[model samples]
Structures are given as structure tokens and as C-alpha cells.
Target: MKKKPKLLKKNEGLNPAAAAPKIEPIVVPINKALAIRVVLMAGLVVLKT
Candidate 1:
């Protein structure tokens, strides 16, 4: 038999550091690279629909 994972209640802090929400930083490429990627993705979506 497998043990169930422990569930933590909202606003319930067992450990201050652990209880805090961890945020990951977004990675953005240079403007020129980003523009090309966006244009390619848009073209793909248009073709798919």
C-alpha cells in the first residue's frame, strides 16, 4: 500500500520559509529574437485553425 501525501492548509504556516510562495523569474530573449518567435507562433496558430 502507498502512503498518502501530506496536505498543508492555506494560511497555515508550519515553517515560515517553506510556507512562503516561491516565484520563478521569467526568461526573456532579446527583442529581435522574441519578435521572430512570436511571429512564427502566430503563423502556426493561423494555419492550424
Candidate 2:
């Protein structure tokens, strides 16, 4: 029983390690897009002023 739980824990750990790289690529693009939009909006505001 203890061995089974240890194996499960290792699998669970690996799952996130595998998933984290996938998630970061997706998140980074979103952040870059948001930053780009913010910069554009700021530029527009400056132009309007």
C-alpha cells in the first residue's frame, strides 16, 4: 500500500512537471498580447491628449 501511494505521488508530480511547460508557453503569449494592447491604449491616450 505504501509503495502504491509513492508511485502515485511520483506520477502526480510528473504530471504537473509535464503540464507546466505547456501552460507557460500559452500564458506568455497572453501576457505579451495584453502588454501590447496596454501600450497601444496608452499611445492612443497620449495622442488624444
Candidate 3:
């Protein structure tokens, strides 16, 4: 049996990319305190994943 092809609405085809969150570049801090926090958070994320 053959199934019919789906027809997308005006924005349906492009909606997924548009709906996704945009990623911003991460800026590293020169300050020691802020840098440590960022490193810890990144390490935790890596371990979790």
C-alpha cells in the first residue's frame, strides 16, 4: 500500500529551526573567581553527559 505525502502549512517546514534556541558564544572571564565558577559548571556538565 502507498501512503500519501504530507503537505506542510506556510511555516510548518521551517518552524523547527526557527523555534530552536539560539546559542551565544561563551566569554571567559579574566577574573580568577568568575573563571573558577565557569570551569566547575562546565566540568559538572561534562561529567553528567
Using TM-score, give the best candidate's number: 2
lDDT of 1 at 2: 33
Question: For residues 4-45, could you state the per-residue lDDT of candidate 2 as single tens digits?
Answer: 998886776689877687679999999999999999999999
Candidate 3 residue-wise lDDT, 13-35, digit = tens: 46756433321122223466687
Winner on TM-score (1 vs 2): 2
> Candidate 3, overall lDDT?
0.56
The digit string of per-residue lDDT tens for model 1 on 1-49 reads 2333343543335665655443212223456678999999999999999
Each model's TM-score, in the order given? 0.40, 0.60, 0.37
Clashing residue pairs in candidate 1 are none
lDDT of 1 at 39: 100
Top-lDDT candidate index: 2
lDDT for 36 in candidate 1 is 97
* Candidate lDDT values, in order: 0.60, 0.89, 0.56
Give per-residue lDDT, candidate 1, residue 46.
100
- Which residue pairs show collisions in model 2? none
